[model samples]
Target: MRILVVEDQDSIRRMIEALVQARGYEVTAVSSGAKALDVILTAPHDLVLLDLMLPGQYDGFEVCRRLRADPSTRAIPVFIISAMDDPESRRKATEAGANAFYTKPFSPIALLKEIERLTTGKG
Candidate 1:
């Protein structure tokens, strides 16, 4: 399945891309939420792994909101993968319509399993 990873940090983004790719998934990663939006709206993706804080006009939350707002992309699964591991952040992510939440330094296994479950209805 196709996975779009949106993370501003270069090292983090690379790590995530590598891990996800290693699991035999097609991954498209971007350094900003703007690029992410552009990519998503233009093409189809099975899942999105987004970081909360971004460096452009749009943050991950806004991206998720936009994706959820548009009927065409509304059903695409979005998972917030951020460093903000607080209750409020989690709540905001939920309110923004994320399918799942994972904090930074997340378990690769859990991510893979979630992707499996979300994309194929099996894990």
Candidate 2:
């Protein structure tokens, strides 16, 4: 499966990339929401791991909204991995069309499990 990971932090991005790659999935990692939108719009991915606080005008919320708004990409699963842990952030993510939300300091194993479940329909 193909997965797109959008994160602004270099270390975090690389870590997630390595973790996902170890799972045998193709990964495309980017540092900005704009780049993420560009990559995702041009190619197909099985899942997207997005960070809410992005470095561009289009944040993760906007990206998810756009993806949901576009007919061609509406069904793509979006899992938000962000530092925002408040209810408001979670609610906004849900309203913006995220399939799941994981806060910072999340369990890597659990994240991988969710990724597998979302992509392959198995836990």
**lDDT score of residue 66 within candidate 2:** 91
lDDT (10s digit) by residue, model 2, range 1-123: 999999999999999999999989999999988898889889999899999999968999999999899898899999999999999999999999999999999899999999988887885
Q: Which portions of model 2 show Cα errors greater than 4 Å?
A: none
Stretches of candidate 1 exceeding 4 Å from the true structure: none
Worst 10 residues of 2 by lDDT: 114-123
Per-residue lDDT of 22-94 in model 1, one digit per residue for the tens? 9998999999888998999888999998999999799989999999999988999998888899999999899
lDDT of 1 at 38: 91
- Model 1 C-alpha lDDT versus the unseen true structure: 0.91
- Which run of 10 residues does model 1 get worst, by summed lDDT? 114-123
**On a 0 to 100 scale, what is the lDDT of residue 85 in model 2?**
96
lDDT for 104 in candidate 2 is 92
